[model samples]
Target chain A: MTLAVLDGGTYYHQEAIYGERLGGRFDRTIYAPELTAADLAGCDALMVADRIHPGVLRGKRPILLDYLVGGGTLIVLGENSAQQWAPGVSWEFRPTNFWWWLEQGGDPGHRIVAPDHELFRHVGMKELVWHYHGLLTPPPGATSLVDITPDGDPQGKGGSILYDHCHVGGGAGRMIVTTLDPFYHHGSFFMPAASRFLGKLLDWTDEAFRTPG
Target chain B: MIDAILLDCEQSETGAQALITDLALGPRIDLVPFYDLERTVLSRTRALLLGLHSDQRYLASRRGQLEAFLGGGGTIVVCGHIGHPFLAELSPFQPIHGYRVDDLVVNREADHPVWAGVDPADLSKRRGVAGFYGRGSNPPPPGARIINSLGPSRCPVDFDCRPAVGGRLLVHAGADLWGYFGSGNSSERIMPQLFDWIAKPSEAA
Candidate 1:
């Protein structure tokens, strides 16, 4: 199946790197900076970074919501861009800006588990690290794969790391909002755990696309 | 009835407590412990104070809930580091790259409500003492206005703002304010003004 990635000039390097890594897994990966509904004609799945959003993709052109409704797998990243671009998805962007403090030295010290989940087939309950920009608040309809816990608190709702396949109409997509900068070239090197997690996500997305609705 | 305060649980809390406590803005502040945020933040609270550090996980989970709470007219105070991936999703502000604390030098906007009691000179003194790391790339949602700024970078170190989602929002990026709050000396000087701006009377029209 073909994977079409929406390009918006932001985080191009990360997408390119992801393309390279997922090369063998994907039959063909196309980068479309100015994506229209027509561009998604033969694509099996679409991956968008911080650039493209629902409003920008609306109108006569092939819209994101339409694509998902039409049975395509869509993955959107970047905390702020996702919030602005995809409104109907039902996730919120918390305004507690703290990227610098974590990079300097802020550790939540917790382990995340999606044990029986499809995404964690290769990566099980691992010691999750905090090194990315910020996370996404999961929509009510979506299922959470990873939850955040700080200092032995029983509730795991602080920092939600992973969200599972959320269905919108006839389409199905998985939204992974993370603070980990997996899109950055250095992200893979800086946080090896994130790189591994991303590989698993791409794999899961591919599987989700191939599964019957 | 602003009964409880909601502080963003992250490294900045250490910094925020320093600043808020020093200012003596006592409002029975509750630091949403990192582990139990959902329980603490989702209570029957009227007002919330968020001190965001540079932790991605904290921003991701809290941004949306805070928006919903604020949209329903909750009071929120955001301080320390700014700009997260989820910010664009929740508000109109876009995260632009490359604005840091060292870039600011003076306050350009003088007449904003968040700055009601403070002098322009005192705010200016905060320029060197306080520094912000992130610069918001997008314009503040239509009605929001700037109260304090670092002239050269055009980065807002302080703001008397409102979100497009319709909540009372206060944003401050000055690192020194955090340092001062944590130090606990000049709190009487700074905390009251902040509380006045954040803690609006429940009956005010």
Candidate 2:
């Protein structure tokens, strides 16, 4: 199987680390800036970061919708800093300046693990140690997954949202909006478990691979 | 027991949706739209999911009711961009905003119950959302033990603050939890952990 990761400047450490660890999972992993409708014509799956907004995505890249609607899988990571083209959502993302908060004693050290999630099954409890800025908005029609909690409280307001996977035209797409820094941060890429988790996600995307019994 | 999960409505549902699905929280998470907020924050509600907005008017209007709810031992989770503002008003600590320093770090509390079985060193190395647009003041509501803190400056990251009013407030500045779930890594593990945290057993009450 081959996969294309949408690359526009936004880089994720997890993606790279996963690629390195699970390089053999897919035949090829292509990183490109916006997969135009035509660009996706022959691709098996597309991994997108927070590059394509709702406006630019509308009809322009029918291939994406078509791919998902047709049983192909699409995974979206990161948040649009400007919230320009994201359809069915509204909110602005604040860049992490790391100045004032650092002086006030703000450090990013926390291991977020969803013990019951399927993606973590093979790896089982991966730890990430980097802080990435996130988006602020409720993604309509998307099912939320994972949340940042302080002292055992999950109701906290500022965290990421993973949305529902739906069939659009002829493919399937999953949208995830997060504040956790995946690529830019360094420590996140160093963990072996983290790499395994990424590999699992890539493998799951393939319809041929069934979860081991 | 509270009947519904009350969420402050302002920013769209991006953040909360993650908790709802990933963590399996809020079968009844209610969105209290800023425009529709009345004097009382619905007496029947059990918890409040607060989202920060640019408009202070909306916050001020609901402050009293929220205070009352907290005093009554209500559960509240504060998130979104205006995390600093909400913490300042609800807790003793005042949140300081703006950019500061580099090399963001998160130190873990060895003795904290939340850190039980979790390694402090491994936890410490984990970097939180950098370039926080918000900040908080005062020590985490008095007895609130600091779970995660800034590197040298000692700013709190993940902590539990208990108001004198008897309510529990959990504060987290990071906003990447939802994305981790959507990444489709360990859905089996992630979902259960999320639901377990969000919907603690009744004994927790």
Candidate 3:
């Protein structure tokens, strides 16, 4: 599948989409400021990074909305605010705990609600104990494939995570948003678990692309 | 007079923006985005803060302005490594070959008021994770006092160099120092230490 990842001038963004082209997942980076509707052509999925400037993204809202409403798969990773750029998404502020995995028997506080879901076929809950950008509350009817356990989170009320999918624009398109920044941790930091999880997630997105809606 | 002018940086996750909101300092963010930096704008400022993710390309090219600002007895604190020739005495950053949060052992080689009773391990972990405090090393400048280090890099995570120009150049090779104020950790002491050292050297002593 042809994947288009947006770059906002970070090493992590470069690695997520352009780092390694493997398993028929040929990822391309769409420079954040320069991305336009014309750049969405022939792309099966569009991935937005966590660290983009909200103002820059607001400028491209029209193009992103167009792609989402036309049966395209749009994946938003990281901290894009719900009130600003993310369509059908609202954000919740959670004190981030980036070091749960470093502790002995540390639980990252997240769980895969849909164990049998395609996303979990490759990656599991153990690999998700790293970090998340923020808690996201998706629109109604959206399936939450995973959730955060209060025990695993320092905040004691773990935020939503793993995978969230929702149909938009009268069910013509599908949008998936996750707080997981596998690309960044893997790209910039060379995190082993994040890399493996990211590959599986990308592969799952590809498999879901071929199956009819 | 501005307490500190944080250089233009990505405000969201990097914590430069959070420092503004959490510290009750508002609207000052508009005054220091590299373009707004001028002799007139900086003359009266007490401090100029540069985060790890600062606009190094813009600030590097305008080193003379910074020198002039320093000449006027301004406090310039850079929180992280730079990509330009701003500090001649300091060495370029050398990435740690095997960087692990555990491998990161904060060792203080010198004493500064900014670290009176502060512990290195306190700054090492944030929200349960480690290593955000310092990732790379800046070769110690002549007479530069080393404050923090990870493992054997000896790269100086936190240091102070008082160049012959009669100004202060404080560098921390990690996240923004001000962001620690609200982390609810012992590292929160960093904010006051930094501010006191900038505002009144005598009190810091």
Compared with the true structure, all predictions reach lDDT values of: 0.48, 0.43, 0.66
lDDT of 1 by residue, A1-213 (tens): 576655422222333343444444444344332456777776777666432222333322347666766766666654334544453444433333334233424544334555676766655544244343345566766666666554322233465555655664424544444444344322212234555655665566667554433
Per-residue CA lDDT of candidate 3, range B6-75, in tens?
7664345565666666544543433355445654467667788876544344465567888877778777
Which of the predicted structures, 1 or 3, would earn the higher DockQ when compared with the native? 3
Residue A129 of candidate 3: its Cα lDDT? 59
Report the C-alpha lDDT of model 3 over A76-165, residue by residue, as the tens digit: 776656357756777676655555556626666677777877677766776665767667665776777778777765567765774556
Q: Mind giving the per-residue lDDT tens digits that candidate 2 earns over B1-205? A: 4433543332233455565543344454554544454544555665555543212334454566767877876666554323124434343323333324342344665344333444434333324444332233234555675666655666776666666665666655443333233433332243234334444523132
Q: In candidate 1, what are the lDDT values of residues B1-205, reduced to their tens digit?
A: 4444644333322455554354344444554544355556454665665543333334455667767876787765555443344354223223324434444344546464444454544544332343232334224445556656665666555665555676566566533233333332333244555555445534221
lDDT tens digits by residue: candidate 2, A1-213: 455655432113223433333444443343332345555555566666443233334434456545655565566655433244333444445444334235424333233335454544442224332333453454545544454333212223444334433433223544444443333231123323334445545555554332232
Better of 2 and 3 by DockQ: 3
Model 1 docking category: incorrect
Off by over 4 Å in 1: A10-15, A18-32, A50-62, A87-114, A124-128, A150-159, A169-180, A185-189, A205-213, B1-205
Better of 1 and 2 by DockQ: 1
Question: Which model scores highest in lDDT?
Answer: 3
Off by over 4 Å in 2: A1-213, B1-13, B21-23, B26-28, B39-41, B54-57, B80-103, B110-139, B174-205
Better of 2 and 3 by TM-score: 3
Question: Where is model 1 chain B poorest over a 10-residue stretch in terms of lDDT?
Answer: B88-97
- Model 1 TM-score, 2 decimals: 0.41
Q: State residue B109's C-alpha deviation in candidate 3, in Å.
A: 2.7
Q: What is the fnat value (0 to 1) for candidate 1?
A: 0.00
Q: lDDT for model 2, on a 0 to 1 scale? A: 0.43
